[model samples]
Target: MLKMAKKHNMCFALIKLSQTHKQQLPAWLHCGALLRTYHKLKDACLKQIHEVKSIKDLLKVSNRPTTVPHHWESHDCICGLCVSDRLAGCKNPHKCISTVAVIINNLTPKFNPFYCPINDGLTLTHCRLEKNTRARTQHRGDIIFDPSVSETLQLAECFRIFAGDTRTAQAPAHRLQRPNQGQGQQEPPIEIYTDSSCINNGKNNAQCGSGIWFGENNPLNKAIRITGKTQSNQAGEVAAILIGL
Candidate 1:
């Protein structure tokens, strides 16, 4: 009925009809704008749906809690810490006690092979890589040691050779060769001693140095010392052993 208007003002008035005139307006006029808005909203929803190809993708896009998703006891929840962070070795804060705390508390302790600091490759059964990044479902071995006993004070098996003991340092030495009694060969034992010193053990600007002593029981023996970038005790120990060997 409003299309019958002859003046421009009359057409504008018809387009801006009051609430009462809405009931009488042509149905097609109201539908065009509504369809456009509905199409825009539907396109946005479809775009979101198409972006997600799998459940994992959907979860990645979801708003999740910052806390751990599963109720796992890092040490004893029956699920070990390795379950999180893609098996890269569980770094859960809860486990700092049952694990590193033993060392801090000056007690003798064994550890889960996955978190075993130096011996992960030897203790973790499934450590197949040259790097000890992954651990097996079952551990390989448990190393027993006492922190109360100092490495220096402990009676090394090697010194027993000088005491006229018949047994050797190691039952089957990997680094030592046996002297044949029949050959009556007499060769001086080679000693390679290593030690590390840190100016400040755990500070930001700490300094660390390692000392290597190589030679027989002679006054002419010499020592070499080296400084490293990191000042950590572990880093120094590892460096000393690596360089000494």
Candidate 2:
């Protein structure tokens, strides 16, 4: 499909629309060669070398009987990952591990890299992406590939929800109806109040949340816990507005 897209002058959006049901094109097509490379590393290297069965395992920090080794001393570790980290001159091998996990778990919007075992290993790339600045932006779930079909589907569904796709039952009504259209009655104005909150505002451990109040007991009401790069009240406010819209 990607070959056909390039061969004929097809817009990328059209390709995405084609795979909206199947979920084949979006992430796979977006990642392409990088996807292949990561999978190859997982299958041919990480699995064989470190016995990684899941993203959780893959992101696990290297724990020796002694304290974690410095980059220069990584050559003495048991795993090839450490040796490679040393060769790459990485000051912290856990950061490298976190990076790989983030790439693979691409579909999760609430992915707190810190939630992983290696909480202190967030890479500079993760930090930059979190800012959501025009200078560096990425569509969160557009570059994931997983061997498990069920897991992939779950991730895709999560991405769709976080991205405000409203096809699912959990979302509010898909289309709002005008009151008394046949009688030419104008639709009444519906008011919605939105707000955001954050704990430990400037700290790394800060948690942000947003709320949408349509009415008491209204199905449209939502309480959202924000995650990822923009873990701030401002971001939560923006998210609340977008979701409400």
Candidate 3:
């Protein structure tokens, strides 16, 4: 069955070619001649080759058709679907569309010339052919997300949320070491450092408040407030730490 189908396809293709080039073909080469050749080839295959259950097995016993030439691979060329070997040396190559169209129309009985496969396989009943052609020609790249705007905004919002959660209370005493008074107990002099800055210092958009406790027992027993120009609340917090240090 597979062998028969392949033979039938080849015969149909040859018939299509012969009918298309009837006027240009030699007197001896015609449909009758092709039909006789086809029968001889078909008979030889049946007698010499064993029957195959599938197309793949049939291909093992048959010679495959040659590939379409490079020039005829693309749809934009003058050949427009016709094989290169069929159109060689034609004077009015531009006028080959009529011959090509006839062959295609016969070979692919299921194809609808008025429809576009990309348009959901629908028949192009009312579409403008010129516009569709231009659109297809101009298509370039696939659509993708634009990361510049949305990504930047999301990052900024996240930073703002994090900055709002800074500790507002005074520094814990556990952070500092205890003072020593083995001899006559005299209290160590308290040295307080203070500075202030804003997150967006120059812009005055957001402000950050920070204090440190610094002493002998307390690492930062002396409290300091840092307030001034800053880019972010984090920067203001950093400034307060520096002042305490």
User: lDDT of all predictions, in order shown?
Assistant: 0.35, 0.48, 0.34
lDDT of 3 by residue, 219-243 (tens): 5554434445545656656766676
Task: Report the C-alpha lDDT of model 2 over 173-197, residue by residue, as the tens digit.
Answer: 1223455567756667989899999
TM-score of each: 0.21, 0.27, 0.15
Model 1 residue 79 CA deviation (Å) reads 90
Inter-residue clash pairs, candidate 1: none
- True lDDT of residue 175, candidate 1: 21
- Give me the overall lDDT of model 3: 0.34
Regions of model 2 farther than 4 Å from truth: 1-185
- State model 1's lDDT: 0.35
Which sequence of candidate numbers ranks them by TM-score, best first?
2, 1, 3
